[model samples]
Target: MTGGHSGRQAYTGVPRWLYALAVLAALVVVLPLAAMVARVNWANFIPLVTSAPALAALGLSLRTAAASTALCIVLGVPLAVVLARGRFPLLGLLRSLVLLPLVLPPVVGGIALLYTFGRQGLLGSTLEVLGLQIAFSTAAVVLAQTFVALPFLVVSLEGALRTGGQRYEAVAATLGASPGTVFRRVTLPLVLPGLASGAVLSFARSLGEFGATLTFAGSLQGVTRTLPLEIYLQRETDPDAAVALSLVLVAVAVAVVALAYRRPGGRGPDGKAGKQASGERPTTAAAPGGALT
Candidate 1:
């Protein structure tokens, strides 16, 4: 009886410390966000947020972020599918290269963009011959945002594809479903949660992007100036408005993550499934020889 009580005490005591640490970590993360919210004046919040420049910046931010996210999905989904399931020499190196944007400083990314798209850049001469200019325009802003946000979408989708089993896909194939049908009806549904989560994350990251947008796209109001740019501009003049704008960005990011959490098939970290279907084809099962399966 004594041994049983001591064992029980040991098990319970270890978790208590862990619980305390978790609470402390939560507090550390939440306090700064709480402070930002508390600093805003509710009375002037509406007028401050509704100002023409603020509204324009917000509109551009949303439009560009949405457009960039769409582009990321179009370009990233295939790359992620390939990287996650395909086998090739230097594939590991390729995956690491894709994640460069996530680790590299945004400023460095902006500079890289300039070298690639600037007037004297490698492709710049060709673009100029076609009477096209990419620098410091609305299109430039979208391109810059897309460059920074694409990696988030790709990485997230790859993880989803890896963990969301291919059992349904295999079952679909056994039922004589066409490759396109299997992907559309089976694989897509299973990874829908990941797609949604990745899109939200990409949108949030695009909206908050500052350095790259400013450096590559420039900070022209009603053109390339996004919410972050607006906030930086306001900081030197109206501190309250700056704080308010910061709060709005924070609120939007939190709302996106909250919505992701509320999505269907949303599982907690510990509740997530392990490895998805291995031996599945990199492409859809419809291809010849059924390589993608």
Candidate 2:
């Protein structure tokens, strides 16, 4: 009995070497971020963060990220719904295409954007005719951010839509609710968590966006330079200031992830109405043929 019990314990246990390897992997990932944060001098941190260029970059990063995140939600949510529920030929191909940005290098994405929007680009002449220029401007920064960050939102929303099911929506439809009404009243609430998480991730990604923004918007102080741009520029001339800015960006990213993982009911201004609609179940109705309706 003792031998059997010992064998069972061994089978259920993780090896010490495995735990050590896991810890080492975590340290490898975390040590660089810790070093960046630890290098910030408290005495100079406030002045560095408040410097003119830093302040401007911070504001621009926030504004552009917010705008991009808003755009992602407006455009991505509908696409996510279609991808999750709608039936169409080549749908699998379309889904893979949507996720291309996530896998593409940002530098490559930036170059592609330049080719699509630069002076000699397909639409560039038309835009110039209308007195609009996208290249090397604040508008370009927002566009770059939106392009790179949109896939994150779409993937998250699609996962939520698939897992959350459409039963409640069907019930609402049976009760004579319009399609839009069913979406707003049933579907939206079920997927709010995923949307919120996706938006936060997109915002964080936009805040740290570099290669694409640099290529499309150019690094101009108080115009298109964001916090990440400021950090890169400072690294060549002022390492201390670079560290300070890096710390700030890291802090913001950490805060966003932390808030996203917090308990849903306990909230301070960020919680939405949909978070309260957690009790509904997926529909179990069937067609006359007895298969999934």
Top TM-score prediction, candidate number: 2
lDDT of each: 0.81, 0.83
Clashes of each: 2, 1
Q: Which tens-of-lDDT digit does each residue in 1-293 have in candidate 2?
A: 46877766635568999999999999997999988777888899999999999999999999999999999999999999999999999999999988998999988788888888888787877898899999888988999999899998888788888876777777667766677766776777678878888888888888889989998889989889999999999999999999998989988988987765566455322323243445546344454544333
Record all residue pairs in model 2 with backbone atoms less than 3 Å apart, i.e. clashing: 167-283
Return the lDDT, model 1, position 240.
86
**With candidate 1 superimposed using the best TM-score fit, by how many Å does residue 261's alpha carbon deviate from the native?**
2.1
Clashing pairs in 1: 166-277, 281-292
What lDDT does model 2 reach? 0.83
Model 1: weakest 10-residue lDDT segment is 269-278
**Candidate 1 per-residue C-alpha lDDT over 1-293 given as tens digits, one digit per residue, 9 for 90 to 100:** 37877666634336678989999999999999898888888889989988999999999999999999999999988888889778999999999888899988888888888778878877777897899988888988988898899998888888888886566677667767777787676676566667777888898889999988988889999999999999999999988899899888888988877765563343432113223322343344444654343
Candidate 2 vs. true structure, TM-score: 0.85
Q: What is the Å distance of residue 216 in model 2 from its true position?
A: 0.9
TM-score, per-candidate, Cα-based: 0.83, 0.85
